[model samples]
Target: MISVEGILFAAALFCCALATAGYLISLLVRRVALAKISTWILAAGFMLLTLNLLVAAVHWTGWSSFGSRHFLSIYAWVIAGIYLGLQLKTKTRLLGAFIAPFILLFLIAAAGQGADRNLVPSQWQGGLTTLHLVLAIAGEALFVLASAAGAMLLIQNNLLKNKKPGPLGRLLPSLGDLDQINHFGLLWGFPLLTLGMIGGAVYAAFVWGGSWPADPKVVWSFAVWVFYGFLLHQRLAIGWKGSRMAVLSCLGLIVFLLSALGIRFCLATVHNFI
Candidate 1:
């Protein structure tokens, strides 16, 4: 018999898939009705995913044994939760076209059947670990939204520049709104990410002997941090905006994601807590 957590997980997966389809249909058809329906469907999916996580936590002693799989699940939950929160604040319903695909990707990743074979030592299972992962994943979720907004801005700008305002372009948020979301993401995400890095470094030094700077994952994380730092500097100091900023934001997100995903598998890293 399927457990309650398993049942909830399956339902959450189905809801996310349907929610993604609803958002995509709304984008292609430019139908306000479909967009509204998609919004509710996504909300339902988010709630179900949340419950699934909660139930799992109850069984596993509340994140004390979290591994790569739990990180992926929490990452997906944060992304979806942030998107829903942004929808309440902004007119970004159409932005779901970009956000939903990521939600689906994360959900699929979370569904992997791998159990935690390398749980951290019991002595290392408290506040710092929780704080580091939570802050880091939350910051990444914001970056994901920022990148999606940037992509929309670029698409909208291209249509305007070429005098080809297609039906899809008509549905996107205004350039100003998209830029605001990007700005919000950067303003908050950078500090959280920095703190997370600091927390991780402290935890590592406390647990292991050194800071593990030679680790490839640490190097990649620093690179990602520097890339976002440069983008923020460009935006605030040089007053970069519109297409240029959009392009950079999207590019930075790709680099951030690649460093997180690709570097983990491609290189030998001590941070592989899987």
Candidate 2:
């Protein structure tokens, strides 16, 4: 028998899948109305996931019971939330065609994990750790959005460049709006990630002392920070935008994913909780 939590998760996943299909169809068929309906469907999935998380938190007796499953779920939730929030300021509804699949993928990954498993050890559970995770996840989620926008920008640029926009071109967002979304992601994400790293560092100092800096996860995270910092600097200072920035954002995300996977599976670090 499936539990209520399970059912809720399943429903949320189903909603996300439907939203993904709706968004794709909207793009292919050039139907703005379908895109609007897909946005509502994605919003429904977000709400259901919120409820599922609340139920899990109550069942586990605290927010500290987060495992890999919960982490992925929250990650997906943040992505959806941020994207929906961006919709208010930008006409990027069709971009949902690119974003919804990622949400679905994360939810699917969450479904594959054991819901009862707690990734954070008892010793590491506290307010600071929770803050660190939340901030870091939000930052990463923004990066995901930035990459998606960048990907769409590339498509839009190519179509415009070739003078072959056709119906598909009409379905995409403006390059300026897509660039602004990328800018928003980098402008906000970098600082949040930096603060999150600071919080983690403080926690680590109290727990692991000097040796924590040498941990593989810490090293990889710092490298990621520096890479993004450079990207941000280039965007603000060097005035990089359009295709160059778009390509870099997408490539940066790819590198981030590869390095993260390598660190998680092949490394021996104290930060393997998630």
Candidate 3:
């Protein structure tokens, strides 16, 4: 008998694989309908990934399987969710081209990271830990989605400025709409992040003795906060818009993913076990 996690992950892998194949097919065939189909397939993949996490939460929460590593899996779903959210406002399918493959890559990496029953922080057993983890994930999702939108906008803008429009250019939403989403992301994502940082710091201080910097997680989190701070300040005070703002969001995610995943896993940071 197959476990729920295996079934869900298998379903997700299949969906993402199909979506990527369809997008790649569209590239050769140049069929607009194929691109639309890819979007729906990608959404299905996202649904499967979310179900995988839900099953894991039910079965592994007691064993501490829902912490940091799970965040990477959730990140893939969150990216898909954000793309779906954008669909309500636009008819662009080009995004699925880049986004679907990116998500596929993340989930594959997530599979390698796998489940970490022992990764849950011993000190975070109470309800506050749940709050911290949940908010931190939700916040990270928004910021990363915003960053992706910014990147899309930059790609679209350059194509327009240079008077050359191709498949990628035609597939993106209007620059104006993406810019608005980017603004929404920064405006909302920053506050949630602030709350996350505060909650995490307090949690850390309680668990790791009096030393506030006991974890490399602390350093990365602080760096992310400061980077976003500069982004927010520039957006509000300097009237920055379009490509410039998108670049900021792009840079933020680079630092953010590094802090969130790269540092935690590859570098074996303090949060590696958590």
Off by over 4 Å in 2: none
Report, for every candidate in turn, its global Cα lDDT versus the true structure: 0.82, 0.90, 0.76
Screening candidate 2 with a backbone cut-off below 3 angstroms (N, C-alpha, C), the clashing residue pairs are none
Model 3: lowest-lDDT 10 consecutive positions: 60-69
lDDT of 2 by residue, 149-214 (tens): 999999999999999998888889989999999999999999998989999999999988777888
The TM-score between candidate 2 and the true structure equals 0.95
User: How well does candidate 1 score on lDDT at residue 49?
Assistant: 84
By TM-score, rank the candidates, best first.
Answer: 2, 1, 3
lDDT of 3 by residue, 1-274 (tens): 6788878988997898899889778756767789889888988888888888888877864745554447667767877787777777777576566567767877777777656555565656776666666677667777876786788799889999998878756656789888887888788788888887788778777877687685677788888888887888898999889999999889888877666666756665656643
The TM-score obtained by model 3 is 0.86
What tens-digit string does per-residue lDDT give for candidate 1 at 165-260? 877677888889999988888878888999999998898887777757888888888888888888888888989888887898899888877776
Question: Residue 192 CA error for candidate 3 (Å)?
Answer: 1.9
Candidate with maximal TM-score: 2
28 Cα displacement, candidate 2 (Å): 2.7
